[model samples]
Target: MVKELDPSLNESEFLLEALRKGHRVDGRAVYDMRLIELTFGSDYGHVEIQLGRTRVAARVTAEVVRPRPDKPTEGMLLFNTEISPMASALFDAGSRSEEEVLISRIIEKAMRRSRAIDTEGLCIVAGEKVWSIRVDLHFMDHDGNLIDCACIAAITALLHFRRPDVTVVGEEVTIHPVDQRNPVPLSVHHIPICVTFGFYANGELMVVDPTYLEEQVQEGSMTITMNIHKEICTLSKAGGIPLEMDQVLRCSQVALVKVTDVTEQIQKALADDKVAR
Candidate 1:
């Protein structure tokens, strides 16, 4: 079996000691996130998000297709993620990784399973045809805290996406081009954003967003997905040393604040784009 080599001993030691002393290499507070930059392409439903050094882009497309046997009345929403070497060296990075799987699951729970999109609205002919929405996610960069960044990109793109105008006449479907008719937006119930906290010093010291170096030395981490309503869509803490109850509760409260700030930022970005359009 091949094993990954450890980080440089001196660099690792420096970061760990700095964190223990409440210092970050970037000179930011423990809770201060790196600057967030969200940009939209000329095309609707395409969004690019840059969280510090990590960058992600999401593109959403729609098509008409037969509905499923069981959920015939509902439309389909598919998510595919690509993490190329351009993103990070840790991954192969074109293929999926355990990290990729974890990121995908959290996003699915927060955006899809939580019923964020009104699938019923996607039905054109109940049990016969429906709209199929596919979101293609690309990781342009991977500094750290990728799951949270990816989730933000996914939900934001969904909010910005619109399906074409369609009419059904006696089992005949007519689709109108964008120039012919304004597209209809998706039925997004809510925007669920994931907030990640990295624990250090035996889970005693916690940071709101950890970069790659912190990730290497941190003891464990937790990701909490929530919306502007303070509803927790999912709380994820994969295998690691157990955290104290106080840590969990404190992180939850902090996560809400982060969620509120991020949600507002996204709304502002979308509104700006709408005005520009």
Candidate 2:
């Protein structure tokens, strides 16, 4: 849905003012993200995230299922979405559309590119049975830059999630809950975070973590997901306008700076959880 904008401010005028101030409409530098908060759960695989005004909750649940016909030895990662009507009038609880498809793809891309979750470790009894982990993301709020927030939430949740231990004896596997034993964490290679940048009209402005209003009026938008090693995991472009190669490169550089802060925050959150426990 097209977010409503302030009646008094026109897109051109807003861009001009921001350009003069060396800042964006939201009072953020071109590479700054709004405040971020993350919470980790001790119970295997629960995470809560807050990015500015947007919030997302994720839970990781596992079940033993027959492995895919071709890949009998590896487990699978399934991503699902639930956009309640309460979250936005634009989305209906029962409806599925292109928006949902794109959201799923963005999350999947980040997961696949970052290798955030280790699927091979999930196998038990090989061809006979394997654990399938399902990640469910609930978009509680969508203030702006859902992709970045969602990616962060997904990765954090995966890192925090733990699964019951499985013991195999004579081809028989038994599962033990977290309470019975220390749960096994999903193997993660690296943590990656996403940052979004918006390019507006007049070659006059760029903004990071655009609010819904800014996103609605921007000429073009791009998201860059980067790992701690400074490798680009995913680069996505949305909106109707075209972007130059130089512009894209500039955005990537800015994204790297922004993602560094994001990654630190996530790591801090994880560390804080350990201290609390």
Candidate 3:
């Protein structure tokens, strides 16, 4: 398996030096994140998010399927993430890379395991049929922080998604078209946003929303998933440099602030879209 070439020694040194001096090449403060922009498609449940140069698109779709044998009362929420070579040369066309696997797992834990969606609300008939919601995420651009960008896209799309209304009469189930009946939105419990921090200089210098170059040269990183309600969904750090207790707490504080801002933006965008429609 081939890998993308690493940054030159001189380039890494220059970046590290700038970071140590509390200066970011992108002109952002040490703990500042890049600007986030959300764009919705004409069709419901389709959203595109741009975090600086990183771009991700998410689409939500639902289907009627038999309920699981073990949990007949609950529906399903599935996620599929695709990273093509077009997003970055490091990723291949067909196979899954290590980073891809990590991103998928973290997202699953953050969204599904965290119970952000009320799966039981999707049931059309207990033990008979249920709505299976699937979220498809595509990485259009990969500057850095694909995980955070993908999370934003996923939640926004899910909130924007509307499923066809279903009516169950005795043993028969009837699905209504959107034109004939107003579609029903999913029961989203809370939005879990991901805040990723890049560590440098052996964890002394840290920055939020690291760029592609910064990622390649960073010593380690951590991603904290939080909601606007002050709840933590997940905290992921895959072995690069161990962090102190104080560092973890500080990172969590930063994550909360970022999540609050992002949530407000999402709400405002949704309201604006509703008005437009």
Candidate 4:
């Protein structure tokens, strides 16, 4: 389904003029990202991210269950998304929008398909019982760049989350509480971050971290998910204007640099949280 953004003649003209003059309403360069802030909740595996005006929260939880027969050695990793009406007037609580669907797909590709979390490491009893990790992302505000912010929130929450330690004695499973034993962190292979680029004027002009109004006026958008190692997890384009091959390569290169910076930020936040804890 087509997710339609409101069109405004006045806003379009204003943004176009600003871009033509090599300017942005928020005074950021074309490639400059808006300020990003991440806050961890008191509980384990809860994180809130603020990217410019967009806000997203992620909560991570785990449950023990029998592993799938086909993949008994591996645990489970699931991602779920929710968009609140307060996030945007265009959002319907009961229905999933194209943007929401797009976000979920991109995140799943980046996290699950990329194997960011070590599922095999999550196994305690192999085929008998294993931990199933679930990450839930909630859109608190939609100022644009929801995908990038959501990815950051989800991954950070996963990093911050700790699962209960389990001990199996003669097929009996015992889950230890935080007070009884120190919670263990998930074994993460690597982090994959999503960076988006918005195009305008037949792809002549582009910007990073577009505002909501800027998104409405953009001609096309592409999201690239990559890790600090410069490995491309996935590149997603959802019916936007066609981009040149060279343009795609250049954007991927830019995404590599951007993801590296984001990875550092996330690591620093985690380090601080550890000290606080």
Candidate 5:
């Protein structure tokens, strides 16, 4: 297993000192998030997200498949996350690391478990066939806060994706090509955005969108998933220093604000893409 080179003691101390003095090496305020940039591909359902130095690409694809017996009517939403070795020295090609696993799970919870997309709407035939919507997330760069970036990429791609039209007659399903029939958009119920907070100084100091060096120097972190409706989808704190109730609430408020901004950005980008095409 490859491991990241830990930051030196001096480097760590310098970052902490700067944070304590109310400054970040990247010049972002404690509560300020990094600028987010979205790039859409020529094909539908392909998107790339740039959050500062971090980069993630998401592609959405669908296929007709047998549905599960227990939930025959509901379509499947699957996520596959790959962290390239070129993204970081800590990652090995064609292998899943602990970090990659955690990121994938978090993304699953944020998007799939939250029911952001209308899975039941994907059913073409009850108990027999359903559209299996798969989201492939490729982590091209690992700066920090991969969970948030991956969620953004996946959700944006899903929103931009248009599946082929299908017709059924007497148990016979006919798939129409994009050229023959216009593709239809997915029935997305809501958008869930993830906002991560890195805690420092024993939880007294928290920063939004910590960079790679800040993540290394931080004591702990919490990830909050919320939608534009001000609904909390997930709150994840992994073995970090315990946070006070007020702190958790404060994080939720911040998450809501950030989620609103991101949702608008996604909508605007999609609108712009439609106009361009």
Candidate 6:
């Protein structure tokens, strides 16, 4: 069963009315996301993201390793996180908290579901060896939603990272260092962006990009990751309450509309940066 609203009934009702009237508490439309700012190449393989006050940074590195027995021709992608104490009081440095685990799982699920990276292309000599790419996410701020910000950071960093070329001579494989002359980019087929929305009161009150306060009060939420082709890559719904099929479909419709704009914004940012460089 859906839970009742908190004691702040007036504020909640006001926000709901505002949303019904096509205005959010933050003055954005129901389908609008927060302002996004992206910075690439701050370091060798680093990307920084700013979604409102929430900040996340990711650095990617690669190394050659033996292929897994089950997937001999595919490379591996590992996602790690370092939750600094400065980022939030709820997180302590070097400690694996519940939030950290959820963050990692969400990222892993999104990548696996979307098949964003072309792992098979990383194979050097088939079963002999393959490249393993590691992405490290550093949480600089915890404004509200970590999953959305982290996913954005991860995708942006992967897009900007370049790997050194590899050559196989007989039984031996050689990996070259990245320099101005030889730099290879990762095989990324599509760009996926995640959009999250809060559902309340029999799905009557819906809001996009919920703030921390709204997240705390909401009974249920859904997240959708859509690729450049407008395909649904990942869909996650949580909250003990059960929702009707029509409600689920309605959420997907709203989410797709928002993801279109989000993906375009990210692509535009990347393109603009390339032009500036």
| Candidate number achieving the greatest TM-score relative to the actual structure | 3
C-alpha local distance difference test of each model? 0.88, 0.79, 0.95, 0.91, 0.92, 0.79
Candidate 2 global lDDT:
0.79
Clashing residue pairs found in predicted model 3: none
Q: Tell me the tens digit of each residue's lDDT in model 4 across 1-277.
A: 2354586788789889999999998899888888899999999999999999999999999998999999998999999999978888878878998878889999999999999999998888878888999999999998999999999999999999999988889878899998899999999999999999999999989898788988889999999999988889999988879999999998998888889899999999999999998
lDDT of 6 by residue, 16-78 (tens): 677678787778777677898888874546888888788899999999899999999999988
| Model 5 lDDT tens row, 1-277 | 5678989999988888888988888888888889999999998999999999999999999999999999999999999999988889888888799989988888899888899999999999999999999999999998998889999999999999999999999899999999899999999999999999999999988899888988888999999999988888888888879899999999998888899999999999999999999
Instruction: Kindly report which residue stretches of model 1 are placed more than 4 angstroms away from their true locations once superposed.
Output: 1-5
* Cα distance off (Å), candidate 1, residue 80: 0.5
Model 3 C-alpha lDDT per residue in residues 37-155, reported as the tens digit of each score: 99999989999999999999999999999999999999999999999998988988999989999999999999999999999999889999999999999999999999999999999
Q: Which portions of model 6 show Cα errors greater than 4 Å?
A: 1-22
TM-score for each prediction?
Answer: 0.95, 0.91, 0.98, 0.96, 0.97, 0.89
Candidate 3 residue runs with Cα over 4 Å from true position: 1-3
What tens digits encode model 1's per-residue C-alpha lDDT throughout 13-122? 88877877888888878887888899999888999999999999999999999999999899998898888777876678346799888888888888888899999999
Candidate 2: tens digits of C-alpha lDDT, residues 1-277:
5533443556657765675677776677766788898877656568878888888888888899999989888888989988776666657668875666777787898896467777778889778898898989888887877778888888888887777888999977889977889888888888878788877664346788887767766777777888868898888875657877888888888877777788888788887887888
Clashes within 3 Å, all models in order: 0, 2, 0, 0, 0, 0
Which candidate would rank higher by lDDT, 3 or 5? 3
Using lDDT as the measure, the top candidate is 3
Q: After superposition, how far is residue 44 of candidate 4 from its true place, in Å?
A: 1.1
Worst 10 residues of 1 by lDDT: 1-10
Give the least accurate 10-residue stretch of model 3, judged by summed lDDT: 1-10
TM-score, structure 6 vs. true: 0.89
Q: What global local distance difference test value does model 6 have?
A: 0.79
Candidate 4 residue pairs that clash: none
